[model samples]
Target chain A: MNVKIDGKYYSGNKGETLLELARRNEIEIPSLCYKEGFEGLGRCRLCLVEVIEGNSTKTVSSCVYPIRDGIEVLTNTKNIVNMRKDIIFLLLLRTPNNGYIRKLAEEYGVKAPSRYLDMEREEDCILCGLCVKACEKLGTNAISLVNRGITKKVSTPYDDASKDCIGCGACAEVCPTNAISLVEQDGKRIIWNKTFDLISCTRCGKCYSTEEVLHHIDEQLGVKTQEYLCESCSRRLVGEKFKEAFQNLI
Target chain B: MAKGIVISPDKCTGCRICELACSFIKNDSFNPKDSAIAVLPYDSVGLQVPMTCLQCDDPHCMTVCTVGAITKDPKTGVVKVDDEKCIGCKMCVSACPFGNMTYSSRHEGVVKCDLCDGEPQCVKLCPSDAIEYKELDGPLNKRKNIANLFSDVFGEVAE
Candidate 1:
């Protein structure tokens, strides 16, 4: 499909959203709730754009909005910029410590805190839903939005150690606020409420897989292997087997 | 996900982070008075229980809204007020069974937990994991884990 973004006509792929098309054309639209891999949530209204379809024009979230032919999208208009500025300001009030939100606020020249600042809650989740979505997509369901209203937060089941968690680290990888982290300490891999015994590579002696993670994987896929080995070592064994077979054939 | 936050009252230590987080997002301040969630600390016994909306299956506040302002979100199962339709009647405030709803003097309207659009902040920042957000089918995860432990150790729940 062909869409006109900022007066520049560009051909977009069939499945690409407006945000993808705009970013591919070097148009950077700020968004907090949209991730490259997941479905567009459209929670954060920062990526609002005025789209003109001949007779009618409406402002929509560029992240979830589809890019189609004859759609003229205005990304950085005066109104859009002001709306983005307002969202950044409110986001700063909620999650001031988040680096991504802070940098966006700085770039938009939001120097002073909003009068909503007589008091504040110090948290870094940003309510972005990236981590929660990532965790759910990983099929662990370990972390979710817990409680209601401002008490809402990302946490494990019953706020206790997650028995279903596989320690995949996908949630941490996609988190924009850096609120979650996977750390190895004392031969154990820990994230949230679950801890696993780190398994060292057979050849390189480097810790790679956690015991709980491997067990969870086995439970999910019915794998019965007992030996603990890293990715490279397993690859090396396969490669060595291939080499031996080739030599015998020769 | 239509989920609810389950609190393990025994684990609470009165840090009040849930209260701070609640008020900050709701009123843009950390004052617990404005928070929808509260940490009720038993001063004599030194016990704290964080309380908020239960997302009841049949909410009294929703039924009592004369102007039809209070409505339940089908997606998240959270009961919310339609501000434009709300006449600030405070009828739902009195109808709430748990008293989680409140009348805000500054805003001149009744306020309650809307589940923060399904991303509650209090559950996110609870240090002791006293609060948990999950679906209704399998809410008490910790209790289930304990039951499993007991089965493992004692070999049966009952004869």
Candidate 2:
């Protein structure tokens, strides 16, 4: 099969995906969720490439779509930028807290969708299949997709305690939105911290605890303080936390 | 003896070359999603912050790994994931404060910055020169001391 990528023609196998062909020729294509050895989920949409031939042009996920004979692939184009931006914008809407996705969105000026989709924005699972692939490829099978269609989620079988989980923490690491947190507490391995913390410092006049005050002061001044008072109050409050040191200083 | 990558956010431009170079060198492909180092952007603020494993002296990832798949490289001070030993538990991923660790869909193992064997591709490819690869002890401490002094004198305004 003949494929023209960015005006450069190359001979490729008939069944090969555009990503596979491009990698074989050392041509760079940006992707996030697509891995070489795993099945393509085409969820991240980071590897969308434009194919143009004759008067027809369309954007396709290069990871799943196979390269056809005499097809021309454009890796970078204005239309591609727009499409990618829209896809990324949708992703951002779902997982707005992710710093990595936010960076990509900013790079392309991805605007927030005008109409809200009523989708749950609680977590940032781009559903890229990293967790699922990690389980299947790594032989752990600790995580897999549960449900079908819009209700699908990467989860353990039957939501039961996974017997195959070796506690590698691979699923939590690959999550773009930090939707899953794998934690070890009291000898039990569990996924937690899925909810975003809405806490903000109240900026109360005395919000910092005694220990916090000392720690912050020590960090800032490069000197250890045994007292709990703010810099101004420390001179007066030194009697409680620092008896010997305050006496000596006095 | 373990070397680490130090990123100064003030100098970062969010070019994402670090992500591309890292994924390319480690995985032999150009994909930011596979890269160990992830660059997070605050679009409204026009700020880009590159995050990766600090390979901390007391690493939370290592402490949290139950099967001990994640280990510290004594020579370069990088935390490495042994694919064969990893059970895909995702514990270390949650333990990391900076969110630097990434799970590989292809490898079924959690991946983090290994400093590229002391020749970091991220530092080489970063257009804004936001990242610096250096030894942890002398240069890093010296730089931190300087930053501390500046921050101390200027208060929070130094940031």
Candidate 3:
């Protein structure tokens, strides 16, 4: 199906979202919560676009809006620009110190927030829930967005060290504002208030994974390896076997 | 039914040719670490066990996937992961019981044996005929008979 975006017709496949098609065609659509390969949440309204019908235009979040034949979309109209500015202004107020949010606010021409009444509420998290979504998708479900309204924030159950968390760092990797803190120090990984011992390759002496994650892999997969070599070292070990096998030919 | 790779650990010489072939064909590199099939060696017993995905009738990876990215095709019986739909969450990596699911750091996604599109490279390259791709009905039936016999022996003892 062909859909018009910014007056240009772009062909898209069935079940393709407007934002996905736009992104495939190299049209920039800024979105905070919508990630590729995951279902679109439409929580962050940054990718809102105006869909034009007969004598009427309806604003929709393009990330979750599926495209149909002959649908015309205007991405950066005056109304959408104003609405995006408002969203960015609100984000700026919530995450006053986040560099990513500040950059978005600056791009949308939102100046420094004048209201200083809630300085104590200043935080770095935008509460976009990307980290929570990533954790759930990984089947761990270790972290979630807890609380309600203004108090809502992502945390482990009871804000304690999660027993289910394997210290894989998927949540930290998916956080848009880098709010999830996962630090490595002294051969241990600290995340969600839990410290996990890092496992180093027996051959290369490079820390590759954590002990808890390896144990989790063992429990689920039911296959155990004798050695603790990293991927590169293991590959090299396999190469040595190949060398020994074809020694006569070489 | 679909053909699957079967390994005979006794026949394996531990040369690691199957790993080289699989990794080179699938990843365009000669890295055994990236191979879908793994050859584990036990020096004490002098045994080499080649492990790969069984593509089970009810795959745990498919059931635990939150985004419905992993699916087993009914016609081909090939369990596959859709790269376009996968979120690099590693859910399937932990769900597999046989340690067959692999998460590639280079590609940033989980990958597993797709039977090499029905011609398993490891089966072809195995020098000792340790790995074979064929219908598993005979082996499965024989294993079921042995299991029944063991259950009979243990059931009487328990009673």
Top TM-score hit:
3
- Report the lDDT tens digits of candidate 1 across residue range A1-250: 8898888899998878899788768898888777654668887788899999989989999888877887999999999999888888877888777777778888999864456663456677766777777666545577887888878878887878888776756567556677776787877878887887777766788776666555554453344444555533443343333233333333
Residue A167, candidate 3: Cα error in Å is 1.1
Candidate 1 lDDT for residue A29: 89
The 10 consecutive residues of candidate 1 chain A with the worst lDDT sum are A238-247
Q: Which ranges in model 3 have alpha carbons more than 4 Å from their true place? A: A116-122, A215-222, B1-159
Against the native chain B, each candidate's TM-score is 0.82, 0.81, 0.86
Deviation of model 2 at B105, angstroms: 17
The runs of at least 3 residues in candidate 1 whose Cα sits more than 4 Å from the true structure, single-residue gaps closed, are A13-16, A114-121, A202-205, A216-223, A235-250, B1-159
Query: What 10-residue stretch in candidate 2 chain B is worst by lDDT?
Result: B150-159
Question: What TM-score does candidate 2 get on C-alpha atoms?
Answer: 0.46
TM-score of each: 0.54, 0.46, 0.63
lDDT of 2 by residue, B1-159 (tens): 445676666578877888888888988888887888776665554455576766766676676554567788766667777764565555455344444676666866667877776788899888877898876568457656644544433232111
Query: For model 3, how does the per-residue alpha-carbon lDDT over A63-90 read when each residue is reduced to its tens digit?
Result: 8999989899999899999999989888
Q: Please give, for residues B60-141, the per-residue lDDT of candidate 1 as tens digits.
A: 6676553466788887788887764454434455344345677676865666878788788898999998888877555556
Q: Candidate 2, which segments miss by more than 4 Å at Cα?
A: A11-14, A24-28, A53-56, A113-120, A185-188, A192-250, B1-159
User: Is candidate 2 or 3 superior in TM-score?
Assistant: 3
Better of 1 and 3 by lDDT: 3
Model 1 lDDT, residue A48, Cα: 94
Ranking by TM-score: 3, 1, 2
